[model samples]
Target: MARLRRRPRDPEGRMTLSEHLREFRRRLFIAAAAVIVGAVVAGFYYSEIFDLLTDPFYEYARNNPQVDASINFAEATAALSNLISLSIFVGIIGSSPVWLYQIWAFIVPGLTRKEKRISLAFLGATIPLFLLGCGLAYAILPQSLSILYGLSPSGTSNIQQASMYFSFVTRFILVFGIGFLFPVVLVGLNAIGAMPAARLIKGWRIAVVLIFVFAAVATPTADPFTMFVFALPLTALYFGAWLVCRRLDKRKAANRPDWLDVDDTEASQL
Candidate 1:
């Protein structure tokens, strides 16, 4: 019988740069595969997804008599292009959990056991928050379309290209989902001791400004109402995270031994 050979382990159990690259490649391939599978599944439900996305546009056209609005396919391949793009978008969203877990797994190797546990908790929180953001975007789609159409002059037909409209809708939802991830990132940084509650509190004004700016840029429409709708909740989440951090800091300080407070350069009093 032939003897089986074991793969050589890295010295000190630490992965080398080449090993790191290989691991990253593996994770990337898995994530891509998951996305492709998701896309295939989404393709099967293309009609349903199309209707769902176009619902807001139809609603706008139905109620508004001043302007005729319709999504038009300009080219012979435009419908196919839209279908492909929409399927990919749904694929990415549907496979978010798998990709998100892959990302978390990639980072887990470098984290301590405790940090890994904390990160797992955050990862669980992240998926739902992202979906929540997307749902909110879908909910406000009608209002955003209303605001945009309201700006168009009366008697002009708003013939929206199907590809452009779907692109805008997908981008809008993606931006919202990404926007909601910032608070989770903030909380994660706090958990890692990288960002303190005091620092967040001190930077409140700047943070608020930045949030509004992000909301402004993120929303598909230029209107302030959408911006406010996006920004206000995020601002609230920031403060809420700060409060959680503040409590965490207090708890940590209370649990810490007094001797640890002495600077490493100074002699400790017995």
Candidate 2:
């Protein structure tokens, strides 16, 4: 195989079509196998998982009463589908490490020593941030559900289909996970000094608006309580990111000075 030399910082390094295909297949197999293993393991606990998943609906059902009666045709199909989906979801989560490693390994060889260190640090920070986000989502899910359910008027609000519920739950986890990583991205930028704290502070107004907007949109729940809860944490993380970036920039400005300045993203470009 001809060694393809390219810049690691850019999204596009150099890779042949074959290389891409090969990597895709490799990642796919590993991901699939991991999911299968996870699903099998989870199969034993499927009933328990279903019960847990249905809790929010159950809560709503208990309170509303009519919601249970409103559900019928699609509900049964959705129930099984959702269980399967949840199993797949867990499998993917369990297998994430394998894929992460595969990705890291793919790029590691191409990276400089400096680049490798940066990549490792990013990986380290990212994994924890994502996990924290997922954990937070799980903790807040019941609350979010309650809040969403609370918004709807007392009617026959049948949340029948399991698929719909699963989608909502999985999406919640994903959005939270990605949202949590927002600060990490910003923090990484600050570490290298790409984003100045002063600028971030200046942009607070816009940032706050954006946070709320994101809360409004990203949230499938679309309930104010849920939106605010999600947005509040992200807003806090944003400031936290700013503070972190500020300190790093200050240190960078004081110490070794270069055209690179304190731009974190540029620094990470190895």
Candidate 3:
């Protein structure tokens, strides 16, 4: 007779150091594969994506004939390099859900089955928030480009290197997307018992200040409107996360065993 195969083990059990490393390696490989697959897909739509990225600059130039703004390739291989770089960036962003899940799974091996399922649901929320942030950044991109270009003297040629422009655009989008994920992080911390809602509520003043600072940096334009717009959603999300955490805390307290909460110094009446 053939030998019976071992049953699948839960990831939460105690493991040797090497086992942990192997698990990490496996997750990393899967995440990398997802990114590669996404990059391959992006390669097929390179032209459309390229045009979409560069359209803002072209539009600005078209609307203002006085400003001689043009994107130029400084090196012989600049175009090819930019294409590869752009593809990799798009891959990283498009496959973020996979990589992000891998990261979460690696750190959360101690989570209970119920907790894992709840956390997975939160992970699903990350994608939409990230994409929403990217969309908002893209919507405001034209104004940012205009603000930067307007600094140059009238009738002067503003020649921008292609690589630099793409780098700026991609970085801007990535930063905004990451910013929108802050609430999810807070909720995750609460879910893991690392942070409580009361603490978050207490630090609201400081958090608001930091959020404003982040919004200012994220929004390239000096105007207050853009900063407020960026900060508002984040502020709302922070409060939302706090509310969720408060509810979770209540549920956790209700489920706790009464004897566990008794004073350690005092004997329990048996």
* Top lDDT model: 1
Name the best candidate (by TM-score).
1
Put down candidate 3 lDDT per residue, 139-229, tens digits, no spaces.
Answer: 8888777777877876688789999899888988887798999998998889889999999999999999999999998765676766887
Candidate 1 clash figure, as a count: 0
Candidate 1 ranges with C-alpha deviation above 4 Å: 6-13, 263-270
lDDT of each: 0.90, 0.75, 0.87
Report the C-alpha displacement of residue 187, candidate 2, in angstroms. Answer: 2.4
TM-scores of the candidates are 0.92, 0.75, 0.86
lDDT of 2 by residue, 91-127 (tens): 7776667767777777775677766786677777777
Tens digit of per-residue lDDT, candidate 1, span 1-270: 999985686533468798889989999999999999999999999999999999999999889866778889999999898888999999999999999999998888787877889899899989998998899899998988898888887678889999889989998899888888887898889888999999999999999999999999878789988899899989998998899889878988999888889999998775
In model 2, the clashing pairs are: 78-162, 192-262, 192-263, 192-264, 193-262, 193-263, 193-264, 194-262, 194-263, 194-264
Q: Whole-model lDDT for model 2 versus the true structure?
A: 0.75
Q: Considering only N, C-alpha and C atoms within 3 Å, which residue pairs clash in candidate 3?
A: none
